[model samples]
Target chain A: MSTWNMITFQDSNSLYSDNLISFHDFIMLFIIMIISLTLFFIVDLMLNKFMNLLLLKNHMIEIIWTLIPMFILMMICYPSLKILYFIDEMFNPYFSIKAIGHQWYWSYEYPEFNNYEINCYMNNYMNKNQFRLLETDNRLIIPFKISLRLLVSSVDVIHSWTIQSLGIKVDAVPGRINQLNLFSIRPGLFFGQCSEICGINHSFMPIMLESTSYFNFINWMNNNNN
Target chain B: MVKYTQLGNATTLETPADLKPKTAPYDPRFPNQNQTRYCYTSYLDFHRCKKRHSEEYEACKYFKKVYTAMCPLAWTTNWDEQIENGNFPGDI
Candidate 1:
């Protein structure tokens, strides 16, 4: 899959994920790789005797190299810390959903809405139009452009609830509740799978979410109650 | 005089290997008496069969039988209701 294209991260659906990708591209394209390539070229020129470096033993060069690396590290660290805090930061969400991981399936609960829940299982034999193992019987529905909190845990072994496009990965460990915030930028279907190696049928656990408009979400809620 | 004997012989000493007993493979036709495992596996199989033969319910009769036999009636009924109402039962 990586070879077909560069296997770039999926087109991000959330602002947080988009920011993360942009930061990644900035570091790789502008800072790290660019500097590394420039250094390599300089080294190559030095080796070819095209560029003479007579200040090899100079204290100024030593100080400059050490200070420059420190400066570069600090630059990288600032944004890294900001993003980490941004991800951890939680706001008042419209609703919360609890996801409990089983051995080979996932169970989602909407606690705010009268204990509404659903078990999502992978569709083993998919139709020609559906993704092979990505399709699930039930989708975790959320409204677009709204802050939603997800509480993750496990009933059996450890399972990681990962949604690559949304840049959310929380380990679903037994007796431990992990929380993450989700804000969908648009209405669409996103697919993910249980990242943790759970059991014999671990690969069968797939996660699918359908983001809808606020009005449609209310309609869905009303429909479910009836 | 004490008889002197070699305490450790590299060739004579045999190390015991760490061994684990192999488990039997799961058989849908003759499932184990454990209802939990049997029902869970049957539930998966039922869905798998249903997905594979969407147009033909007769083809998945074996899975349906296994699931129906293994899973409790209450659980099956609840799940059937949930499916009917577009709500998936969280428990099998």
Candidate 2:
């Protein structure tokens, strides 16, 4: 049995979770920036009081504030650009799934598995027992500990496929395909909703992904086909 | 295995609040199944839903069939309940 660690951001059963070094790096940089900005503000406040004294007549505080922010911005920009490029670079994937977005629903296709396809649409009118907008007829099932490539596209309008737990979010454009690298850590259910406002029913486009062991995943794929 | 949501009593299913509305097709007064005539030029809204006319239904049916063949298990709809609820099958 695997122990669950909430302190870590690593997903339950994934390989690309290790590749998420850039996101963490940017987060650390962001924290440093906040601290630097806070200190700069404090120093500016002190210097403002000090400058009130006619004896010390220098434009030093203004220069420091301008230069410090520029330095901080440069620091933030470099890592931000690097992370964007790294995420865009597509590595060889173990498996791929094509996700299609409609007005208020999502459809998925596994081309490699005899074109096994699944349509997962949210049921808005959940009878007394069902989850509203968050419930779908079919859930996306993937294996833990494998690199999965997601190809996202839309049929009608633009939408965003986002699943924070897996740290995956990609845009679904009408005529173009957007690719995303996703991998999950463990065998459990995780949920997310459409990040973009596509239509009135946009809120109804909920996503449910379940990660399982490689063997169990294979069994699921087979069962789905049968 | 599928279940509906229970009300505050936690034992009864919450029926739709509007037991019947003006849009209810079950009302015999408007049995012709009235729908708005939507012009393509005027229909560019976010939730713009296109309704095919009788003549266009043939082409729409072909497209639906092709789509279903492309993705079999995903296209089927529950017809009986949908009909009772005044919802069109394969509308999307």
Candidate 3:
């Protein structure tokens, strides 16, 4: 649910994305705490008449400064590292989708379905309900509440396949297959664009992924076969 | 979970439209962000691919796509000439 003028993060529909938002909030806590402490110290120094002209060598102050930053860093390390590894951990995916980047468009293939490839181009001509430069003629559909492994590659220059709301960004380089792990708890439509500048039409190629139930996905597959 | 069992017996999926075409193996040699090494290495890989397999091998064309994407047309054309003249430095 990324909107044009939205300032904050979009809603989280997956576990990892929710964890990512929690981590962000955790870091923001530290930032606000440090800022408030500094502001208090600055204002007190200016308003109070507590000026000491004596020698400024104190073991207590030195120990406090050294130990405080060390403790803060340690506090920050565990959660950050935990999130880094947690997002990277990939369980056995339920399905696989291969996304290939082209000069101006994207193609998707369901290797589980005998390499069923679909060329998804930008739907420039769209009604008011559709998003501009963010919608494609054919959308990549995955089952809701299922884990998936997405393989990304490029047929031309480097392009990046990323969905910010999902907290996933992967480089699609020619001659290589980069893998991204994804799982969603709820069903929704997510959109992204080729992050890496490939050519003149870099901003044109967009990705629209829809998540539905397993039953509907099967029905869609049956209809697509005809 | 019982519903998911239908996938095994699913019929063939439809072929995508040929909208016109073709990275990545990771190598320590090209660790940097700039992929110039990929440009040249992919060229050599295409030739090496054609050499090991038949020229018309489907997989060999993968390397060709890699090189075409990484290297410019002029660079590939020049390398093609060098390969034909037998003056290319890289061994097949």
Note the chain A TM-score of all models in turn: 0.88, 0.76, 0.91
Better of 1 and 2 by lDDT: 1
Chain A TM-score, candidate 1?
A: 0.88
Calculate DockQ per candidate and list them: 0.01, 0.02, 0.04
Docking class of 1: incorrect
The estimated TM-scores of all candidates read: 0.65, 0.57, 0.69
**What would the per-residue lDDT of candidate 2 be over residues B11-77, giving only the tens digit for each residue?**
1222234322111012132122111111111112111222434324555444333223222132223
lDDT of 2: 0.57
Tell me which of candidates 1 and 2 scores higher on TM-score. 1
Residues A1-226, candidate 2: write the lDDT tens digits.
1124656554423333333444465557668878898999898898784544555556887899789878877866664565455555544455567788988889887755666778898865649786566778899988765656676777788998977666577778765556666666567877778988999988888998887777787798888888
What lDDT tens digits, residue by residue, belong to model 1 across residues A13-125?
Answer: 87567667766765675476757989998888778845446646778878997998787777766776776766766544456677889888998877555557789999868
A159: Cα error in model 3, Å:
1.4
- What order do you get sorting by DockQ, best first? 3, 2, 1
lDDT scores in order: 0.68, 0.57, 0.71
- Report the lDDT tens digits of candidate 3 across residue range A1-226: 6776998788876656666677777777889999999999999999999788996799999999899989988877776776666565554455567778888898887645434668889997559987888999999888776667676777779999988777777898876666666666667899888899898999999988888877788788777776
Question: Lowest summed lDDT over 10 consecutive residues: which window, candidate 3 chain A?
Answer: A86-95
**Higher-TM-score candidate of 2 and 3:** 3
Residue pairs in collision within model 1: none
